[model samples]
Target: MSIQLRPTRPADIPFVYETEHAAENRPFLLPWTEERHRQALAHPDIRHLIVEETETGRAVGYVIIAGLTNPHGSIELMRITISAKGKGYGRQVLRQVKRWAFEEQQAHRLWLDVKEANQRALNLYLSEGFVIEGKLRECLKTGERYESLLILSMLSSEYRD
Candidate 1:
């Protein structure tokens, strides 16, 4: 199925909320409140996008791009969540994001951090041309414990397109 990214609407918040807190996805991400999603939607610097299956118009995933409003030419891929995994959707979404960040946004650098144990996602990022810059140790609190994250990034000079 063909996938598309669209500007997230207010109505999409419920789905975003549910997806972020979904049992499978929760471990890899920090929990976000509905109000936080709302705030992101309202922020000029942030881009909250809904990833949809074009043919069925079903919302399958979401991605958040932050730090766009700055003049530093750097953008942080704050979050990416695919409700349905292992179907190659995440790869397609990452390709689209790279295109948008480099070709459209004209960004110099695009970066993201992934949980160290998320081998699937780490592999995906590596395959997508992101280089592991470093590791942030015990930087995020998941609940009762803190976890380390691997910082990965791609620069415009290194973008294939």
Candidate 2:
């Protein structure tokens, strides 16, 4: 099946909330509240894109690009979920999002932080052209223990799309 990404609409909230609230997604969230999601969905600098399954037109994934103004623009990928992980869809969605950010948003650089233990995500980011910039030691408290954070980035010129 093919996938198409487009600007997210208010009507897409339920899908967004459902995908984000899944138990399996708890580890990746940034302790976001409902109000945060509301505000982010409406924010101008925050580019929110929804990946739609072409045949059904249902949102299968979403990505939020935040902090878009500076020349060294850093976009925190607020969230990205594909119902099922380990599939190739996540990579495709990320590439499409990066293309949109570079070609449409005119971003100079893109950056994101991943937990050190999230090897899958780290691998995805690296394979997608993001290089490790630094590691923030014990930056996030997942539960009772704090986890190290890996900072990754890519320049506009480095992006193929």
Candidate 3:
């Protein structure tokens, strides 16, 4: 299914909250509070977007990107959670983000960090040309144990489209 990303509306916060904290997605991500999501909408350097199906116009996921106007020309893919899986929506949205960051925003680098256990997301980033930069070993402390996050990035010259 094809997807289009649009600037998120205030009404979409609940959907974003629900999707991020849902059992299927919660463990892999650090859940943000509703107010935090609300704050992101007004943050000058952040882009909080909703992913909607082009055919149905329903919100299936959301993406949080930061450093829109960084002096270093580097942007971070803060978070991306697609509730509707198994339809290639994640790849489509990621490609769109890459185009927007490199072509439109003129970003020199686009980067993100993914939990080591999230092999699915890691594979997608690697396939899309993001090189693994480093790993923040045992960085995030969960309830009992720590979790590591692998940092990955792609430069403007490396983007295919």
Candidate 4:
């Protein structure tokens, strides 16, 4: 199945919200409000994109690049969600977004913090060239317990190849 990543349109706001609100995704993303999304569309440094299935024309996920700044170039994945986890959309979207960040944004580095238990996502990031730079113990509370956070990063020079 073909897939594409395009600049998110205003009409995509609701679908983005729904996809992020799905059961399997809720815990992985920060909670957002309608006003937040509206503001996001206007945010200068944030690049938000929507993922669409080409054959069925369905909205499946979104990728958000936030915390952009010059010189000290850095980016954090504000959000990423896929309707289904193991269907390969996550990797496709991640690679595309990383390429855009490396080429268009000229980012010096891209970084993300994943819950220690999110092995699936950690594996994807590692396979895509992000290295485990550090770990923070009990950094975030997932439920009744605390979860360690793993900091993963990939440099622009590394991605250039």
Candidate 5:
């Protein structure tokens, strides 16, 4: 849970794309193309970051945050994809992201939507202090199947640590 977040470079896109498309992550979130990742890298309102091991400097995952320009101080936790699951890296990354969004970015609220079936991530989010807001019933069609998402958020005033 002590991973480091570094600014993502062009070369990082392949890993990011691959991670997004990984079988472990594919069911939980939508996958983006390499070109889309590249475009996001150049977007002012977006922050594309690589999550690495603190001591080894090995990249384990990536995170995307958006709405930096939101006048209302609300930010989106766009995506988080860790190549390996059950390693506590996701929680580490979530904690880091909370600090960045609330303390560094001065965001009043940070929110994310997760697939309803992603119980692991949903449990993580709830345990980390994000409150359930609502549910988007069948909002996305990944393939022949439709998926619903649960929206969760945390207010800056509710932040801890």
Candidate 6:
């Protein structure tokens, strides 16, 4: 069960887009267009990576990290999408992202906002040592309704490794 993250290539965009719009993943994330992904890929501040199963060389998921080019020590875990669930892929991806942020990137803080109703994601973030900083009420509008988001963060000092 070896997993690795690699730079996302242009050919991987469609798979990433499909995973982003998958029924199981859509509810937890904001709507996005293919152009947005392309922009991220081109942006100096963003890193778009594809998560692969090392044994099979299959892409299991993808992640988008932002604010890396900023002088500030804070970075955002902009997006992470796992095509398959219930197999610990999210946990593994998150652990790798944290290590990259705190260790490799020398970031002092890593943060993200999750929809409050996304219990599974909230649980994963909490279990990974991300602390809830606060809640933003009615922050997003999906269709005709508004939703709240919970802000979670992990500081470099709080990182285990």
Q: lDDT of all the models against the reference? A: 0.93, 0.77, 0.95, 0.82, 0.92, 0.92
Candidate 3 global Cα RMSD? 0.9
lDDT by residue (21-72, candidate 5, tens digit) is 8888888877888998999999999999999999888899999999999999
Which numbered prediction scores highest in lDDT against the true structure? 3
Q: Which pairs of residues have clashing backbones in candidate 3? A: none
Q: Name every residue pair that clashes in candidate 6.
A: none
For model 3, what is the error of residue 40's alpha carbon versus the real structure, in angstroms, after optimal superposition? 0.3
* lDDT per residue (tens digit) for residues 8-120 in model 1: 99999999999998999988988789999999998999999999998999999999999888699999999999998877889999999999999999999999999998899
Question: Which candidate, 2 or 5, would have the higher TM-score against the true structure?
Answer: 5
Q: Number of clashing residue pairs in every model?
A: 0, 0, 0, 0, 0, 0
- Lowest lDDT sum, 10 consecutive residues, model 5, at 24-33
Model 2 misses residue 130 by how many Å?
Answer: 0.8
User: Candidate 2, which segments miss by more than 4 Å at Cα?
Assistant: 71-75
The estimated TM-scores of all candidates read 0.96, 0.87, 0.98, 0.89, 0.96, 0.96
lDDT of 1 at 83: 98
What's the ranking of the predictions by lDDT, best on top? 3, 1, 5, 6, 4, 2
By TM-score, how accurate is candidate 2? Answer: 0.87
Error of 1 at 83 (Å): 0.6
Judging by TM-score, tell me the better candidate of 2 and 3: 3
Better of 3 and 4 by lDDT: 3
Per residue, candidate 6 scores C-alpha lDDT tens digits across 30-59 of 857888888888889999999999899899
After aligning candidate 6 to the native by TM-score, how far in Å is the CA of 156 from where it should be?
0.7
